[model samples]
Target: MSADIQKLGEVDRMIHEPARLMVVALLSAVKEADFQYLHRSTGLSKGNLSVHLSKLEEAGYVAIKKTFRGKYPLTICRLTERGREVLENYRKVIRAAL
Candidate 1:
């Protein structure tokens, strides 16, 4: 009901976007996930996945590590403590809102 709460709600909404949320959810479930893994799990193309990944990385909610597996480069994503907290808060807010 307060302005601060409303602003927090807006931020929650932004990170809770369908694609971004799925990415976060998947990462939260696993220790680390590769780009192909996320692509398969979310059924999102590389470009779309990259876009959403960039957003999450930009927010510092996720950490992406780049490495090489044989001849190919791998992008492994992990959820940060900040991300977990935000997701938990988001869950609480959603339950309260509903």
Candidate 2:
């Protein structure tokens, strides 16, 4: 396997968590999405989604925003530039490995 693939294999375990991976994948697919959107799409409970989102945010892969939409509080998440680079590198590693 290539060096990049080998490197990714090590990092893979970190981002490979089911919920976190889903969050990353979904956010990567879109510019940004709300908390409810992720919760609904992943079929995870609010608490569960919150926990995972916190972890991803701590890891610096995602950024969270708190705002009000028509007087209703909203939490929106977006992937960071670092996250996009990591995901792209991961894809490259996977392609090379395969």
Candidate 3:
């Protein structure tokens, strides 16, 4: 193959995976979303969603916050500035490949 294609192959494996990509894509559109909202949107199980969120958080691609909404604790998710730039670059690379 070519150097260009090889570079494309280097797409961030973490974000390239389908499930995680969906999670990032969904979060990219909104200001922030709660756990339940992501659960319903991604159709991923609670456990699965939690795991993905943790990975993203660790990557510094997302910021997860726990806050109290009255008597209940709410978990909110949002892509960080760096995350947004990465997502956009991913899109560019994929589009360029096509």
For each candidate, the alpha-carbon lDDT, in order, equals: 0.87, 0.85, 0.92
Q: What tens digits encode model 1's per-residue C-alpha lDDT throughout 1-98?
A: 75545655555764789999999988889999999999999999899999999989989899999999999999999999999999888876666555
Candidate 2 structure quality by residue, lDDT tens digits, 19-81: 888889999999999998999999999999999899888888999999989988889999999
Report the lDDT tens digits of candidate 3 across residue range 51-82: 99999999999999999899988899999998
Q: Each model's TM-score? A: 0.85, 0.85, 0.92
Best by lDDT: 3
Q: Which candidate ranks first by TM-score, i.e. highest?
A: 3
lDDT of 1: 0.87
Ranking by lDDT: 3, 1, 2
Question: In candidate 2, where is summed lDDT lowest over 10 consecutive residues?
Answer: 5-14
C-alpha RMSD in Å of predicted model 1 compared with the true structure: 2.8
State each candidate's clash count: 0, 0, 0
Error of 3 at 56 (Å): 0.4
Greater-lDDT candidate between 1 and 2: 1
